[model samples]
Target: MDVAEILSHHILDHHWGYSLGGVELPITTHTVTLLSVSVIMLIGLYWISKGGASTLKRLLTAGAEEYVTFIRDGMVLPNMGTEGKSFLPYFCTLFLFILLTNLAGLIPNMKTATSNISVNAALALCSGGLIVYCGLKFHGIIGFLKGFIPSGTPGWLVPLIFPLEVISLIIKVCVLALRLFANMLAGHMVLISLLLMIFIIGQLSAVAGVGAAIPAMGLEIFMTCLELLVAFLQAYVFTLLTAIFAGSVIHTH
Candidate 1:
């Protein structure tokens, strides 16, 4: 069996059809999953904000708001400070969108969108853009550019340090993208490899396949549970780091 081909079937984008946009583009599985996640989040936000009248509805809404509150109180306020309150919605949306997409992968026959580097990079770009915006908003263009150089730096070192700082900013975004994509991809790869072993061994001998099945299934189950936790953890980590980075820029000297 071609292991690489199997992995790509699961990991790579599966195009369902071509969309006639400004240019023809293949609409892939991730596109549908992401759009679904977006719709769900919007409906959830409306339900949370509307404050449904029924007792059941109210309880469910409260539970939903608790997660949103965690982002606001736990992540944003502590890291980004009260000044970051205005952007609470953006952070909340980011966390929830990621959490949903991550969780979706656990469903049978479904895949995680965040496993795609392009998707993760797009997310990082959004966060990076926000960081740049915060810098420009709080400090003017001159002040923002000057913030890269430290207060007591020597004149000669200023030029060297400035370029490094700019490069550092770009690297931060790349890191965010790579971190999420790699983490998600790694977990799924492990899980996929475990299951594939059963099929590969089965071809050699029935008895061997049966023996491998027990351990392979056990590991797959364990990985699934671990992946569930990872889904939430990755979402939180990305959101928290973004807030911290934004906070740093906002409070820069």
Candidate 2:
């Protein structure tokens, strides 16, 4: 294939080799990757919660426990405060699930679930629901609605400010979804493009391909490492923002 065709393949969605219902509802490679990752995560959870006498068992479990402790102490407790302690499990699950999915994309032949806008949107919806629920629980429905009103505002501005605040709240949730989805999608795209260049150059001329492959492949490896860090960073950013949103609404100070 030519360079354009090779690059195009990277940009397009990949399909499963075969369809279950004759294409009525085709399960794509992404779906299978997501399912596989989910199963591995569930197995990890079992090991995380279980105990064994072997040293390897203890070491693995310790790492998982440390991760849980770190998120609870570092993210949830700090942002949510003491009153929000009960929400630790919720945030922990969110962090780990997103982290796993993000890392899954780096695995050979695996797709990143978080890179899908639909998946990210669903996660944002859940966070938004929690924000609203916490706000209403801490303050009554009327009080929560009134929280949007700025202090010492003239009666004339109340009407305008109220609608604006409502819109802002919805936008906040949308930003959350887009932030995760965009980052994950863009990172993978860059990596794919970088790797595709080597193949494209080589197809045109063997010598040029070999020469281009050296730097191209080197850069691809560097980007892969950077992407790994981004995977963790993006997951942490999403969870941190979710906690902050909920905390702000719950306390309102």
Candidate 3:
């Protein structure tokens, strides 16, 4: 089934309305779901703060700290260097936001915001715009444009390579947006289809349906774990790519 149909089937809508300016607004099921996730994350932070260096609390905090440090040291610093430290806050927020959004979907009755293209595109635009802004700030407009064309290309190739380079640059942003959207959307669709299959089989015969359900339930559990990994991996990939893009502009090859 198509993503829209699948999402519409599962994503409960709270309400719809027109704004004062006549813009349509959807109070999506996922929005409320995300509010709860935000509260949970905040509570986690509070727990860490209040645990006061207890062994379990320290372990939880250490795990969280390690993940953050890994992203900074292994992903961001390698590409953007010491100057990359300045961008850490933005990248960290992006990672946590997407991670939480992905995790929210695993909960019963919750919609995945990352499954929505608009949401993923907004994130891509935010990251891409930051790259462009940093590029411009680091190397004036002329320099930023010049950074697009690879050094040592023949003069004749400049005419072709320049436009190709620009297109490639734009494609990077498009890929970033589509990758996360497609992954989340596809995962949810698979889950829904699996569930539907179990229901269909169960209606045919109780025994057979239960038999079908066992494997499907197992797969769903596996996918849930996979989704958690994807959540962190995608965030890392996005931030790492952004750092690489920004680095390329700052220190053009």
lDDT by residue for model 1 (124-228), tens: 999999988888988889988998887898999998999999999899878988999999999999999999999999999989999999999999999999999
Q: Evaluate candidate 3 by giving its C-alpha RMSD to the native, one decimal.
A: 3.5
Highest lDDT: which candidate? 1
Q: Candidate 3, which segments miss by more than 4 Å at Cα?
A: 1-7, 11-25, 34-64
Give the residue spans of candidate 1 off by over 4 A.
19-25
Q: Give the backbone clash total of model 3.
A: 0
What's model 3's overall lDDT?
A: 0.79
lDDT of 2: 0.84
- Tell me, by TM-score, which candidate is best: 1
Root-mean-square deviation (CA) per prediction: 1.7, 2.1, 3.5
- Clash count for each candidate, listed in order shown: 0, 0, 0
Cα lDDT tens digits, model 3, 1-253, are 2445654677434454546577666566766766777787788767875756578988988877887798799877888888778888787777777888888888787888887777788889998898888889888899888988888999999999999988987889988989988888888777777777787788889899999999999988887788778877777777788778877766776
Q: What lDDT does candidate 1 reach at residue 150?
A: 77
The full ranking of all candidates by lDDT, starting with the best, is: 1, 2, 3
Distance from true location, Cα of 8 in model 1, Å? 0.8
